[model samples]
Target: MGNGYLRFAALGDSTTVGLGDPLPGGGWRGWARLLVESLQASYDVSFCNVALSGATAAVVREQQLDQALAHRPDLASLLVGVNDTLRSTWDPDRLHADLDHVAGALVDGGATLLTVRWHDHAALLGLPRVLVRPMAERITRVNEVYDDLHATYGGLRLDLALMPEVTDRTCWSIDRFHPSELGHRALARAWAERLCAAGLDFPLPSLEAGGGREPSWRRDVAWMVTEGAPWFGRRARDLGPWAVRRALAAAR
Candidate 1:
């Protein structure tokens, strides 16, 4: 029935496409996929991922935004701006404008929005930390803009860069710039919790306080922007929500 179905699309950059954690399966399992499997049972969800590996806000403004909109989804997610900051050699103002433009496009597309946070951790990763912190702050400024737009439009927004769980070096990618596989799982779990708190009523794993667990979905989201595929669908593979209910029943 229409009541049980949801169409979702993802638009952004490398993280959205799963560049940080490449799998041998030939498909990069990112956070969006985690989201897909998480909701597959409760909602007859169709997912379209149109994220590029090195997209800037400008690139998204020009290209992928249209592709995502074409999917006609009810739920849409974006994870852009890192490349905008990392590659902006012309003007900072332009980068900020690009952010606005892309967000505007998604809004126009009539999809509920979710924005990922930006971060830099070379310092925590044992690098000199001189590289991307300033860039990260500029990213922070842009994320604030994203926040305003989401609030104004009545949507969800967050920043992955300032997340506490990601301070540990283990969360960084092998290159120390992206998030690791573990980081992706944490991200998916967090976002599920966010949607739940927002009255989404989706299935989610319990957060354990001994490991920084709380009602705070923000911490998990802060760990990684990308969600890997292998980590998702673990509990709900093959079986329906009835299977999930059965598992819960057995646990009791």
Candidate 2:
């Protein structure tokens, strides 16, 4: 595995798409790309990332799963379920079923699957106090799904929730949802470390040195006004009503 060529594919939502950490030439350089670059230092690696912002688990299963499978990747990463957690109609069991299918298929295809437990974003996002517990519960349940799948199939799992640095303000973008550049670097380093610990040898750098440029307040403010506000408005128009209806149904 180490000497041969490697194909890697990443599938998920906004985080995997790297919303906060934009590339100078456009698009994003998320943790998936960083991990791939690290591996590229040694192995002949070809990488593909098919992640979309605002994508739910079902959407990922429907859209990206087939593409990832077609790539016949030797290594695959799945980082979904956050968008599902945000929805009012979220069903952890259903989400788990979809993810189980994805994991099962990739493993059956002989790909080494990798996935991470979601961090508690609600706490850092400054959500209304009333919404925090519910959101936290949803996140916990989703992570349990990841854990269960990993236990059933041999794969690597990183518990980002337990990592305190992930919750720090510096680690997040102005939107408070996506990771900042520094945060992305932290994630990449973590993944590399985890992979190495799991016995896959690769040249990984120290977390402290060569961290990317720090985001400035001016850029942050500009992004909030330009991108964040529009994103919030879209979510309100599209997702809010659907979520409300689902919440109401659940209450009934």
Candidate 3:
């Protein structure tokens, strides 16, 4: 609670950057923004969202962490590592170390850190059979690191893997990774409920989906061509060789 108001910082990757939930005029609005809005009813809040698209754990540690810490947030959320799993550079030890640094810094600074256990993104994305196991293994490792951090830091955590809504196609955009507007609304509601349950003096945000335009097939197709394809190409270039090497070692 610096500057006479509660400060909230959000850090991670595209999801936190609000890529799936487009604003009507232009920009993006995600669950974190919704959560901050909810908090404003009871308390003045200063919110900073430093998450970028396609960022890895190392990226958050090196680039976003300092920005977040500067806000001196009363609460902060960290959700990342899916992009790391997509790259050839994926390393569990390095991922853990980066996360540890980010989490430790926030908690040490007296911020209540929020973490998440990721879902099986490979299954959700319906990735190629050859890539599924490798991706799943990496996601599992990421979740394990989150579990350790939650235990060590004694903060709130959301288990997306166990959330049945996460499996529903309606919760996801066309890409099946980022959540749709309704999905983001639900996530914000859930976080508010958790904070209230943890004895934070704030009312829960409504679970209703509002102010969101329904997604259309035409728009979805356009996004697939313009955004999705290029993103997939970039990931494939890096992830392909690593997957091949893993497959060869398995065959041996």
Candidate 4:
């Protein structure tokens, strides 16, 4: 694997699509790109990212996973489940089953799989105590599935939930949900380190550097109006009704 060119495919949602890490030409250069670049320094690497913003794990399994599998990558990364956590009708058992199917399919097809456990963003975002507890619990359940899957399969797991740096304000974009460019770079470095530790031959670099510049207040305000408000409105419209229904069901 080391001697030949590596084909890499990234799957999942907004994090994999790189929503917060804007590029000069309009698209994003997320952790996937960073990782490929790093690998290209030493080996020939072809990369594909089939992640869509606002995609759920089920959507990834139904839509993106097939496209990724078609690429027949030597390595693949799956970063999902956060969107599922926010859903009102989230079923952990179903999520786990879907995850297992995806992981098994990828590994069975001969790709080295990589996945992540989400950080405790509910707490970091300063949600109300009521909201935070439930959100945290949901995230915990999702991560437990991640742990189990990683244990059963020999995939690399980036335990971002345990990494304190992910919660830092500097690592988040204006939306406060997605990782900033710096955060993405940090994530890429972490992945590289894990791969190297697992015996992939590559030059190890310092992970502390390469933080991207912080956005200015003016840009922040513009984003709030243009991106943030619309995002919030959309979520409310889409998830609000489902949430109400779930609450009613619980009460019954």
Which model scores highest in lDDT? 3
Summarize candidate 1's per-residue lDDT along 161-251 as a digit string, tens digits.
5577678665556445565555665676777878778766677633321222222345335434444332223312422344445446656
Q: Model 4 — TM-score against the truth?
A: 0.88
Worst 10 residues of 3 by lDDT: 205-214
List TM-score per model, in order: 0.72, 0.88, 0.95, 0.88
lDDT of 4 by residue, 84-116 (tens): 887776899999999999988889888988998
lDDT tens per residue, model 3, 53-97: 989999999999999999998899999999999988778999999
User: What's model 3's overall lDDT?
Assistant: 0.87
Clash count for each candidate, listed in order shown: 6, 0, 0, 0
Pairs that clash in candidate 2: none
What are the lDDT scores of the predictions, listed in order?
Answer: 0.63, 0.80, 0.87, 0.80
Clashes by residue pair, model 3: none
Q: Would you list the rank order by TM-score, best first? A: 3, 4, 2, 1
Q: Candidate 2, after superposition: displacement of residue 34 in Å?
A: 1.2
RMSD, one per candidate, in order: 16.2, 2.9, 1.7, 2.8
Instruction: Please give the distance, in angstroms, between residue 223's alpha carbon in candidate 2 and its true position after superposition.
Output: 2.2
After superposing candidate 2, which stretches have Cα over 4 Å from the reference?
Answer: 205-214, 233-252
